[model samples]
Target: MTHHPTQSPQFFLTAPSPCPYIEGQFERKVFTHLVGDKAPEMNDLLTQGGFRRSQNIAYRPACETCRACVSVRIIADEFKPSKNMKRILRRNADLIGAMHDAEPTTEQYSLFRTYLDARHRKGGMSDMTVLDYAMMVEDTHVDTKIIEYRRRGPDSFITGKGQGELIAVALTDKMADGLSMVYSYYNPELEDRSLGTFLILDHIARARAAGHPHVYLGYWVEGSRKMAYKVRFGPQEHLGPKGWDRFDTEAV
Candidate 1:
């Protein structure tokens, strides 16, 4: 007879810290390590249960008083880009994103540093060094990928790869039912291109092409100006006590 071992993940609670999203609120997270052969399956289950992945850790808010952080996922198949979103697409028509293995490169680290320095100077990840960035990209146990965005070259159609400077990058995970966007960063100088919005739209298109039903966008914290853009992706589902439910931004 053959014997197989079952993988069980042990969970831990984080010490409370000042919330980055809401004022006068504290944040705590319940997290578990994601490793070994069954990591992909475990990631899918935890993501569906409102957990977000960071490197090898899967965490969800466990605050005592605040229930403002809500998990959100885009309905990829039924998504229709609004006029502004269409304009963003048109504005960035010259770019193409090529999916690659989750390997860290110095080029990517340089871009990441510039982005953090310019945009998130005071954020938690502001102090990340090259080693830290490399670990973020490489320390994964699931089906993870990095999509590098650049200007479409003349031979882009033949090679399916872009050329010149790297414009943006997305670190994502492939799940059983959907694609979960772990993190993404772009060149801050190209603000006019609305690269952030373009990244989400491109992911929606990618999810649809891959026959995935949803594109997980992490948490949407209520009353956080920084998270308000997430709601613009309409017809998305928000995980609540009763499970995932359709959220109408207009009605709120």
Candidate 2:
């Protein structure tokens, strides 16, 4: 099959499915395929309009009557790490991350398996086989990078590549506006490190160093406490009915 460019990007809504992040509510997505020669350009447009790229699909929530999911991106150059976030950094200083080209591997799939079983056993991707994980990384048509975090090894610090068991991984997209984290997971056993928070902080630093102004953090669901931590990254701009606007709510 091939992709054809329409005058405008066509959006198709998905059938209802059980919500992965929130309980009791169903979820739907309005998505378009990112394929063929125009996939890259199409993806850029979709993402700027608040969609998240997953594999070859660009998707956004389309739940009936629900507006809980709001797009969020950090102004990297203007961001300052909070006291708590600073602590998370020093806490995980032993851990190091190496960014690699988007390539699928057995090792990545193994970590993905462990993460889903330990943290998201009840979620939709819990049953994904290695093939699915492969597609998750390799099927991307846009510029993508896979950043893997592991324990520091003998030659790692100098080489800038870690050599040890995979502790965490992030599937991120490089867009014209900023780097969008498509998905991220960690070793669920390491609760004290707050690996999730550290990853977000690191991404902000990365975007800043790369000269990108924003670091897209996907959506921030209001009522979902599990996702509430995302808002802690202060000086964020949330996409509203008007457009991307700055919001500063009291920190948790």
Candidate 3:
């Protein structure tokens, strides 16, 4: 296949599959391979067009009848934490997140398995083995990083990296506009700390520090209880029929 750095990619559609988020619905995806020298540039363009990268592929919802899966990106520079979010940050104050190259390890896989078994037992990735986990983290062609959240040790300030046991992990893509949180998992037992929310918060801070404008949070489905938490990140932009639009219910 001819690689086109400045041209549109050839997209293929996936066969219908049961919708993981919405019941009684099916999901189809329109995807293209992210490969060759132009992969990074292509990935960036597609991401701005609401495509999500997975391994060597980039895909988006192409359902026939449903449009509930809306692409959501937080406006990092303009975001302000809510009172509850402030509490979550305070609760996890003892922990630090260290960004590392996209490499897999046994420890991360162990935590991944534990997280899946506890929280996503019936989800598609629940049965993935260690090798599969490794591929998920390392197979991407575009820029990716694994952020490890660990309890702060005595030397954490100087090292600028965390120490001790890993409590959460975020698989993120460094996009041109902002950081894209591809996936994140945390110790399910530590419900009070709200590690998931903290990860998003950290991504926002990271994006702002890097002078990026947004943090992609993948798709948010309306009425899907699994995705309801995404709405909490206020002043997010949702890809709509008319392009990106501000979606703040609080303004209503």
Candidate 4:
């Protein structure tokens, strides 16, 4: 009898830590590594199961006492920008996003540092060094891409690329069902352009143009003001014990 090795992944639980979203609450997680040749397939399966990727690891909140973190995915094809969203898009009209292989660069790291210092100074990733940033972008085994947003140049229409200053950056994962926005940062000084909202809108458009049905936005923690903006995108779905279902913000 011939024996073939099993390729099942092993999951481990993280020790409880202070929740970053909701104060006075603790958070734990179940995680597994995303390595080897089967990483892409495994990533897709895990993502659908409510796990989010960070570099080579896929994790989801697993607190025994709380279930506030819910997985969210925008229904890309069905999404329609609201009046304010339309205004944000118009405000960022001069910026263009060009996607490329997930390779880190000094320019990206600089922008990343500025964003962290200005907005997320107390967040978990606030102390990441340049090497850490590179690993975050290049350590993934699954299909990933880095999108660099820049001001549109005069020749942008012909080149299909942007130029002059890296205004924003997004690290995304291309899953079978949708594009997952793993991480994103932008020029905090460009508050007038509303670059953060524009990135999400741009991803929705990209997903729709590619014929994808969803755009994964990771977790939306209930009662977390920081995550309130996620629910503003209509026609979204939330993963629950019963599976993915329509999320009606009005009913919340």
Candidate 5:
């Protein structure tokens, strides 16, 4: 078969590895480097087609037998907080999330370590060093940012920054269509605050304010308890064989 060069990008597949979300299943991925002049545009196109970015590479699951990993993006403008989610918002009212340029800090890495140890101690990223974390935050070529959440300070309203201890952080990418939440970590000690859910809630608000219609939440596997929370932020669309399709809460 003659291969036609339809574009500048080249794709490659990864060797199968143990699936992190599901036990006993192996997962493979198709990926391409995201760089140079067309990085932003290509990132946007691939993301809409179910690909997610990690550092400078964009990848999506390409397992032969399993298709449980489904891409989900929230309809920012239409999301309504449930009673429990509203309570989470109230619990974290003292916290403020300020957006900053894609920069890494020792303080951020410290919290990242703590979170990984507490929540994902056995996961692949649990052993990431400070330098590894830095690359994860700063290696992107597209428009990216870090949102730091902290207690509201006296001058927070004017400066749009908080002053107390860092409670959470979200590494996000700004696409032409929406914000893609690359990764997020929070103070694992504050389990009562539900910071993970709070972060998503905040992202929805941020995307709506920026006039973006969606907030990409990465892959949501149906049978994985770890991914069940994603379905709560409804009026979301799932990428499928026919393209993006509406996901009904009842159907899930």
Candidate 6:
């Protein structure tokens, strides 16, 4: 039987694995490769359609009989920082960020390994090698960029590059509407830095500066502490079957 190339996009299924975010649950995913000349274009379209990337694969939750992982994005222009978010940003004032091409390096892999070991040792990526980590950063086929955070140096304003140590790294997708944080990690040792929160805060400002309407923050599972932070970025929208639904925790 003949088939259309685009319509018959190659798809693959992942082996069942334990869910990291939720207890007593298993997870599986159906993925397709992002490669070749059209990879960037394909990645953009697939991401807009709700797929997340892992190295060369574009995937999303494909668990049988479950639809709990709903995608979400922040309407950056409308979003206002909560009291806690303001404090978090103030606490991280010393950090300076440098944006660069999505290219991987030894220092980045070192930090990535350290983060996984300290924060996600038992999770799926704990066993990843340096090469594996490189692929994660460098395999992107989209308009991907890396934001490196470090302590502000003497020449930071001019260089826009921070020094000291790579405390945090964000793998972000530069979308037409706004930035999509694909993945992020920080030096697990500095618990007080609140790098995770700072990263989101920075992205909101970034989206506003770029004249982008939204900054996609991905899913926010209600009962998960790990995901609860996503909700703090007020005046956000949660994607639903009908459309993007505006939600205000204070109003609820």
| Candidates' C-alpha lDDT | 0.94, 0.86, 0.91, 0.92, 0.93, 0.83
- The estimated TM-scores of all candidates read 0.97, 0.92, 0.96, 0.96, 0.96, 0.89
User: Alpha-carbon error at 15 in model 5, in Å?
Assistant: 1.2
Encode model 4's per-residue lDDT on 27-118: one tens digit a residue: 99999889888899999999999999999899999998889999999999999899999999988899999999999999999999999999
Candidate 5 accuracy as lDDT: 0.93
> Can you write out model 5's per-residue Cα lDDT over 163-193, one digit (the tens) per residue?
9788999999999998999999999999999
Question: Candidate 6, 97: how far from true, in Å?
Answer: 0.7
Q: Candidate 3: where is the Cα deviation over 4 Å?
A: 1-8
Ranking by TM-score: 1, 4, 5, 3, 2, 6
Compose the digit string of candidate 6's lDDT tens values, residues 30-149: 899776667777777766667777777788778885677777788899888878788889899999889999999888898898899888898778899988888888877678899999
What is the per-residue lDDT of model 2 for residues 1-252, given as tens digits with 9 covering 90 to 100? 675564566779999988866777899999987877777778777777888888888899999867889998888899998898899999998888899899988888888899899988887799999888888899977899999998888998688987778899999988887789899998899999999999999899889988999989889998787789888887889998899999884644
TM-score of 6: 0.89
| Tens-place lDDT digits, model 3, residues 1-252 | 655343556789999999998889999999998877778888888999999999989999999999999999999999999999999999999999999899999999999999999999998998999999999999888899999999998999999888888899999999889999999999999999999899999999999999999999999988888888888897899999999999984742
Residue 100 lDDT, candidate 4, scale 0-100: 95
Q: In terms of TM-score, which candidate is strongest?
A: 1
- Cα RMSD of all models vs. native, in order, equals 3.0, 1.9, 2.0, 3.1, 3.3, 3.1
Q: Candidate 4: misplaced stretches above 4 Å?
A: 1-6, 250-252
Local accuracy of candidate 1 as per-residue lDDT tens digits, 1-252? 432233878889999999999989999999998887888899999999999999988999999999999999999999999999999999999999999899999999999999999999999999999999999999898999999999999999998889999999999999989899999999999999999999999999999999999999999987788999999998899999999999997675
In model 4, how large is the Cα lDDT of residue 249? 65
- Candidate 3 contains a number of clashing pairs equal to 0
With a 3 Å backbone cut-off (N, CA, C), the pairs that clash in candidate 6 are none
Residue 213, candidate 5: C-alpha displacement in angstroms:
0.5
